[model samples]
Target: MSATPAYRRGMADKDFDFLHGRWRLRTRKLRDVMDPTCTDWIEFDSVSEIVPAFGGAGNVELTSLATEPPQEALTVRLYDAGEDLWRVWYLSTRAPGYMGPADEGRFADGRGTFVCEEELGGRLGLVRHQWTRLDTGRPRWEQAFSFDGGESWETNYVTEHEPLGE
Candidate 1:
């Protein structure tokens, strides 16, 4: 018989259950994520709905923003119980055509940090997604990018999720 992976030993399927609901989103993003001196930011309010799928092992999040032309996005998250990891994929109307790179990670101490590499300004760079304050009843997410293999990073986006009454 094969032994189970150590990371999977105690991991549960309810890891993402907290996301199954509607939320009001306070979002901010840097105007130029790759430019060091571009401190300008755009902030907006939006709404989101997360639906559970795959019998609790996966979820789909749909977001809508009433921007100038109206905007929408979708995020898909899947947890691999046997691998003890979660993978996320995102697509935004702001960027048509291709879905962004996949981010893979597992929760630790009520926080989840996922990482992936993607092209930025014509060069490959590392992108990090952070999930924190999860258990504190105030969940937030941040995104950062690093060109030096994580030796340095600059936060480019943040979203504070406020749960709305059903």
Candidate 2:
């Protein structure tokens, strides 16, 4: 049998190739997500593994956080060939049986940004996640929330990913 040719693939099929690997992440998060002036930030460690699926059109990510009680999260990313965008869904052990809101976006200029509507601290808000490749070829993820539409945003979490062996 002959193997499939890589060049024959479409743009939506390989957008997340950079995330396919094991990673160790250092996370810095604000203690209070709603309070922008809160300077109290907590640092933690986490690990993540991502693997391609759906014949390279999708991916699954498993992440574990080193919190006081220890938490685990999962994310599924699927690409829509027609729309040329990626849709993301997230879930966590902290809130069992409930999947978070869907976030949709595309990667551009080597960075990816996704946004969705969700409830944070009992208030409706817009949540955004950003992915960027660092100068060292590593990856970084940032999470922000906007309570008043998209006019203002407060960065709540930031994570830097380094390959497990590196």
Candidate 3:
């Protein structure tokens, strides 16, 4: 498919240890059909709790803020299944309006990428999020979108994770 190594899936557990904790996210604003240049940015504090289910696998629920409507209360969680190297699924309706359906993907070699595809008003679209571990002990999360097919992309958001209890 995407040239992912076979060994990658087997080592999911060993490589995901760095994700357990509290995180702060920073995302650059995205332009919409209404606004061409996104001059604002958003930030949030998130917490990830991992709990075991069965068969040596587990789940993670991440709670984050919704800056707009339902202000100070709306939140969304990203669900993860450990068996697939914590492949994530978006499971809440509280996120901002611009965000689309549940984007999903996995972690490998200290990197993670997830994407969501949507078709609205007769136009096809895609949203992708990626995470990469940096030498500073922080994982960087970035988001991009495409209108064509996977040929072009535009960065819409960015976040840096700092493990809790530091």
Among these predicted structures, which one has the highest TM-score?
A: 1
Best candidate, lDDT: 2
Candidate 1: pairs in clash:
none
Q: Report the CA-based lDDT of candidate 2 relative to the real structure.
A: 0.87
How accurate locally is residue 50 in candidate 3, as Cα lDDT from 0 to 100? 37
Error of 3 at 78 (Å): 11
Poorest lDDT segment (10 consecutive residues) of candidate 3: 70-79
Per-candidate total of colliding backbone pairs: 0, 0, 0
- Cα error, residue 17 of model 3, in Å, equals 2.3
**lDDT value, residue 98 of candidate 1:** 80
- Give residue 34's lDDT in candidate 1 (0 to 100): 86
Error of 3 at 166 (Å): 7.8
Cα lDDT for residue 60, candidate 1: 97
Q: What are the RMSD figures for all models against the true structure?
A: 2.2, 5.0, 5.2
**Model 3 residue pairs with clashes:** none
In model 1, the worst 10-residue window by lDDT is 1-10
Off by over 4 Å in 2: 1-9, 134-136
User: Candidate 1: deviation at residue 157, Å?
Assistant: 0.6
